[model samples]
Target: MQPIGTTLKQIRQAKGFTQKDVYGDIISRSFAIRLESGQHDLTAGKLFLILDRLGVSANEFRFIQNDYQATASELARSQIMLAYDQQNFPRISHLATRYAHSDNPAERQMAVLANVLIMAFDRREMVATPAMAQLWQQLTLTKTWTLQEIDFGPIILVLTVQKKQPLAATIRKYHLACERYVSAEADPFHVMDARAAFDLVALQLLLNHQQYATAQQFKSQLLAGETAHFTSDGNLDQQLSLWIWEGYFGDPTVAANRAEALRQIPSTRFKLGIDTLLSTWNKRAAAYHQRQK
Candidate 1:
């Protein structure tokens, strides 16, 4: 994980393009230096042009970040699946507890997924004792349920009930409700709300069968709403949800839009989260390009 500045500097040098060659007349030399050093934030359009001039493909710019995120997500998913397969309630419980204390976004996502599984198979009653309830209370109080975070909830639920009759039915019904909510609402409270609902359902569908194309269609519908105008607080969630979708779908344009939306929002937390996501995508794109070479 090279700092973004170091990565930019290396790419620039590798391309044999002097700062004057790329930044000449368009931007001051000092400013260009600052940009490469990560001292100044670049606008979406500006960043694109800079990368273009540097001869770095979008995929190359994003690959490492995406690879990191994918690894974390897969690791979390694998752990949950392992616990489920072994019927290791205690291990699951341990993971869930560890998850509660973790600040890493990736690990937190895994914890949420595990809890969903625990809820579905073991029954909420299984983990609903006073101890778990206290943990749940803490989670709720943190107000940390972002769109990416919520994706794991339904996944855990779906996986837990895969072999159970009544529980599976219940999980399906909940997923259907979420899907219907996305399809029926003309204007959701926030775009992220709709996207979150859509992702939850789509993820469940994918889990049931390897239906990538269908899931992608559902994803397109989510993307179509990105152009809708939104206020800072009013649609931040929607935009964030869309950011997650764009990240997974490999759409740089959507990622740009998400970055712009985050800039518009006033909250530090929102900005930080969006920035991390954008950086991840940019690096992911870079990684993808590198693989092609």
Candidate 2:
């Protein structure tokens, strides 16, 4: 990988920003020169400050530095759903092992996350691992989570419900982050893009765990009285997901038709998730009926 300074220079130049523009008051021109020349390394504080000036995320800069391929963390994350859709345990296990020893903390976190995802998506029981304990500690201790934390935050929730642990704090943190993201003032469009995902994940998990009141509250918030908070009203994936949830909580016929609609679309990623949710609803309903008997 090229030096971070080299990456900064390339992005800065490509964006037509001078050292003066990007380093503006953040660092001296002499310091900037050394940074770009690879003579001086940037401290984390200054690196983030300068990165903000250049309008690039730390991850994005790293991607540019790595010759434009997705970083190990990014690649693992992107493949997570495909792994779920195809039930590719071996593929995901390979990913976990491949990146388990990375020097970068993000890559390592993704490795643990991959392991956790393998268990969580399959809805298998888990004995909490040291990695999971550490993940929670970090989440609880950090007042403001980074994009990575927010992205992986729901796995903790998924496993939390599976383990039948207390949900108050984990649920609170996930909602606060999503709440922050959906506001008009929220920046970092990519992170803002994750708001819907956090909502959907939390809603599904809450429903799966029979936290009906909490799940309905989330559903109400996501709908905002039928307004499209996440997208224009035309988004079929969102509509189907909401309908499926509604079918479970309210109208079965509406939900079935929505699921059928998604099924008819052979290429949609939403199909797998919706099918899994319907299965969850069926299991939960059967258990409820058994309890009544």
| Clash counts for all predictions | 21, 0
Question: For model 1, what is the alpha-carbon lDDT of residue 37?
Answer: 79
**lDDT agreement with native, every candidate:** 0.54, 0.68
RMSD of 2: 4.3
Q: List TM-scores for all candidates, in order.
A: 0.36, 0.73
Off by over 4 Å in 2: 12-36, 40-55, 85-87, 97-108, 162-164, 185-187, 224-237, 269-293
Model 2 per-residue lDDT tens digits across residues 78-185: 876467545577888988887677888777777777787777666567667776677767766788766666777657676566556766567666657655555554
Model 1 per-residue lDDT tens digits across residues 141-231 = 5333443333344553344334332433433344444343343335343433534443444443442343444544545554444334334
Q: Could you say which candidate leads in lDDT?
A: 2
Question: Which 10-residue span in candidate 1 carries the lowest summed lDDT?
Answer: 163-172
Model 1 — TM-score against the truth?
A: 0.36
Quote model 2's TM-score.
0.73
